[model samples]
Target: MPKIEEAQPKYLQIAHHIRDQILRGDLRPGDEVPSERQLASSWKVSRPTAARSLEALSHQGLVEKRQGSGTYVRSLEVNRRARELYGRAKQTGKIYTPGEYAVITSAGWLEAPDYVAEALGLAVGARAVHRRRVTNNDSGPITLSTSWFGPEVGERAPKLRDPDRIREGTLMYVESVTGRQGSYAEDRMCARSSTDDEAADLDLAPGAAVLIVHHVVYDLQDRPLEFAEATYPPERWAFEQGYPIV
Candidate 1:
C-alpha cells in the first residue's frame, strides 16, 4: 500500500481512532481488526490510508506486523518487548581499549545513591573522587564520564587527589597499586538514562542522549578492583565488544 502524506498524514488520524478503540476493549486481544480494503471502503479513504492506519497501530503495539501475513493484535508485554528491541538495535555498543586506560578527572558532586555504594562496597556518604572527561576521537568530549574511586584510594596517590593530575588520568595509579598483574581489564555496560546535570556536564542539548558506561578493573584473582562510569553521546562515541567464538 502507498504511504500517507509525509506532512502530517490524515491516515495517522484514522490510526489514532483505531488505537482508542483497542485501548477501550472494543477491540480485544486476538480479535482481528478490519482488513485494509474494508477499512478503506468504510472510511471512504484510499487503500493506502487504510494501510497506514494499520501500520500505525502496528507501531503502537495495538497490532503486530508479520511478514507476508496480515497484522494481528499484540499484548502490552509484546509492545514493551518491541520497544526494548528497537532501543537495542539503535545502540552503537561499547568501545573499550586493552592495555590503555583513559584517565578521566572531572569534578562531580556526591549525592548518595545506593547503587554507587553497593558497587564500591562502601558505606553511604563515603567520599568518592569522580572524574569527567570526554571519550571521543578528536571530536572533543562526546560522552561525559565521571569515573569514581573511594577517597582513600586517591589519597594513596597524591596525584589522584590533585585536580590537574587526576584530570590527566588516574587509572594508572590504581593499576599500579590495587590492580593485579594483568595488562587488560574488564568493562561492563548497561543502558541508563542521563540526568539534567549529566546532560549539562557532557555538553549535550536538553533531552540529548548518552550511553552510561561502567568500567571495572580486576586483579588476576578475579576480585573486584576499581569501578568507573562514563556517559557517551551517540554522536561522538561508539563501543565495540568482541565475544569469544564457541
Candidate 2:
C-alpha cells in the first residue's frame, strides 16, 4: 500500500496542514499566513508548490489573498457538509475533521441491532463489530457516531475491535486489510429528539432536537462494508450542499 502522504500531492499535503491549523484555531481568522518563501523553506518544497497550497485554500473559501499583502485565514460561519467531510477523509485518510478528534467510547463484538443488521444485510442478532465514538472540537462534543461492521471485517481487521482510534479511518483501514475498496456511499438523514445516550454523549438535554444521519458505504462489488449512524445537535451543526440545477 502506498503511504498516505505519497498518495496526495505535496501541495495538498501542505494545504491540509494549514487547513488543520486554521480549523484548530491555531491560526485564527485574519492571521497572516506564512509567505511562499517561508512555507517552501519550511516544507522543503518549491515556491510554486507553496503558492498552489495557498491557492487551493483560497478556492475553498477558507482563506483570502490581499494584493501587496499575503494570504490570511478567512472568517467563516458555515454549515458542515457531509460531502465535504467525506471528501476530506478520502483525501487525508482521516475520518476526523480538521481540528476535530474522537474518543472511542466502546469497541467490541455485539449482536447486530435490527437496523444495523438490515443495513449490513445480516440477520437480526448476528454478531458484528460495533464501535462507538464521540467527536469533539475546541468548543465541545459535536457528534456521537456509532459504526457497525460485519464479523468478517472484524476478523480481517482486528483493530476494529480495539478501543482505540483508527488513524487511517475505519473504512480506509478495512480496505487496506481486506482489499475491498469503497466505491460509493448512501446517506439518510432525519431530524428528531436525541435519545438518552446520545444526549449524554453530546452534552445536551434529553429530547433536544438533533440531526441523525445514517451512512452506508459499499465496496466495489456493491456490498455494504460499513454502516454508521451519527447524531449532531441541530443548532450547532448542519449538512449543506450546492449544485447547479439546469
In candidate 2, list every pair of residues with a backbone clash.
none
- Candidate 2 runs further than 4 Å off: 1-82
- Candidate 2: tens digits of C-alpha lDDT, residues 1-246: 112276568888788777755554457678998889988888888999989989988987789999998889887643343444555567666655556788999999999989999999998889999999887877788878899999889899999999988887777788899999989989898999988998999999988998888999999899999999988876653423322244
Question: Candidate 2 at residue 109, lDDT?
Answer: 96
* Cand. 1 Cα-lDDT: 0.54
lDDT of 1 by residue, 90-142 (tens): 33121222121243445544643556666766788777666555543333444
| Candidate achieving the largest lDDT | 2
**CA lDDT, every prediction?**
0.54, 0.80
Report the alpha-carbon TM-score of model 2 versus the true structure. 0.70
RMSD of 2: 6.8
